[model samples]
Target: MAKRARPGMRRKAIVLRDIDPPGTLATNLFRAVYNPVVQAWASGAERIIAAYAATVSEMTTDAPADVRAEIDGAAEQINRLVLLLTPDLRRWALSVEGYVRGRWRGAVLSATGVDLQTVIGPEDARQTLANYVEWNANLVADVSAQAKQRIGNAVFSGLSQRKPAREVAKDIREAVSMSRARSVRIASHQLSSLSGELARERRREAGLEVFAWHHSRKAHPRQDHVVRDGKLYTENPALVGKKVDGIEVRAAPPADDRAGVKPFCGCRERAVMVFEFDD
Candidate 1:
């Protein structure tokens, strides 16, 4: 007689199998930013692979064959990405490291007007970068764990054959949907964190204002622009054109092409300029 495994147990096993790849999964575990590129670069490839596998597994649970095929494809993609990155990042890291030592170090110091002796020092910078890489690696691992848990829960939930089969499909779909949305949000937050650090470093080296342009062209009667203290304010035309003190207002080409400056919007119309006094 063939031994029978409970649906829940079988589903759980399948989920685990899909999540856990065979062999050493820690091939590219280092951070590319700090490590000698080749030594510490993860290429974000592992996360990508895991995400794809989770997605396909959730969608194809009803068809065991499809799930298995998807897993194979995901594995291949992961391997290919890692293979391509191994040599590329290694060479890049060496080149970048050499550049930093030969020219970038002096240029960065000179441009930022930061005294190497007064601040944390070059040795400290390297240490800080290393710490950052390790922190991110830990974060990735935690996220991966949570993702696997979600997949397991979904698979087990669907294993209840007592429920309508469509219900199971719906459960799988919802689980995959939530997983993808959450993953995107988490990745976005991480990227934002990194961007913030880079921005701070740039600001510390050279004090400057960073402004992003937002587009607003609904072309409604209620829409109007107003001038405030050296800036533009908007609400409705009825509230616009109010006189203000110590400010100059004029219009110029909307698309600014000054060296080092780029226009934020594609609108070819003229943009109002507002200048204000310190007082």
Candidate 2:
């Protein structure tokens, strides 16, 4: 029997990458500073005010010079970085948290004996995967856009003498396209890691068989393409390329007790049945 992932223990491998980038200092520092404050606030907003006051008092003028300097340096770095990337970081972080706690962990638990809906919420498992894939695609778009903007700004910032407007525009455009392309590639790599983490979670779920399933964005499954053998292959054409043994891929209702999934799940429209390998 495969060992199950511990409850409340997040997937370690991909979570690090999904974290928001720091403006300065170590990235984890932000989480360190923010998590406690947030936890305090969540527990009791009134008491959190007193806790906040205590935290403020902890930073006294009599503190050692070395300690003060270290704190100042870290603060400055974070401030600078936040100014530069706050908008993007904020947007991405919201999505990342949902993917980890709700999407990723939820699925892992549902696959095992735990009822995710009862433990967390009904939407936890499916929402986790859905938001992960959706936000990942959005991250690609945002990165591409930011890369283009960066390249354009970089080119204009340069002191170029006697450069024609049209020529400069064309050059900047090409550079931006290349930059966005690179960003897409990098984001794709990150998403690939996320995919692997999801797969790992699926493997760790107990008494359930999980299969990777993709369906067409449109109503017609016939129109979709899948990556196989380092090439794009259509469903019809690839059916002849390889034979899957005793693996019947089809769409069907989940077992009645499956994490208490409702009959008319909103995700059902996009769902494809994946084989669960369970004892």
Question: Can you write out model 1's per-residue Cα lDDT over 97-196, one digit (the tens) per residue?
Answer: 3333333234334433333344323442353344444554544444444444454454344443333444544554454455445444443333333222
Scored by lDDT, model 1 comes in at 0.32
lDDT, model 1, position 84: 47
Instruction: Give the distance in Å from residue 197's predicted Cα in candidate 1 to where it truly belongs.
Output: 1.9
Q: Model 2 over residues 80-172: C-alpha lDDT tens digits? A: 433444444344434434444454444444444444544443243454455544654454444434533443343334212333444444554
Q: Which lDDT value does model 1 have at 131?
A: 48
Give TM-scores for every candidate, taking all chains together and pairing residue i with residue i. 0.32, 0.30
How far residue 254's Cα lies from its native spot in candidate 1, in Å, is: 38
lDDT against the true structure, each candidate: 0.32, 0.34
* Collision count for each candidate, in order: 2, 6
Once fitted onto the true fold, the runs of candidate 1 whose alpha carbons sit more than 4 angstroms away are 1-125, 202-279
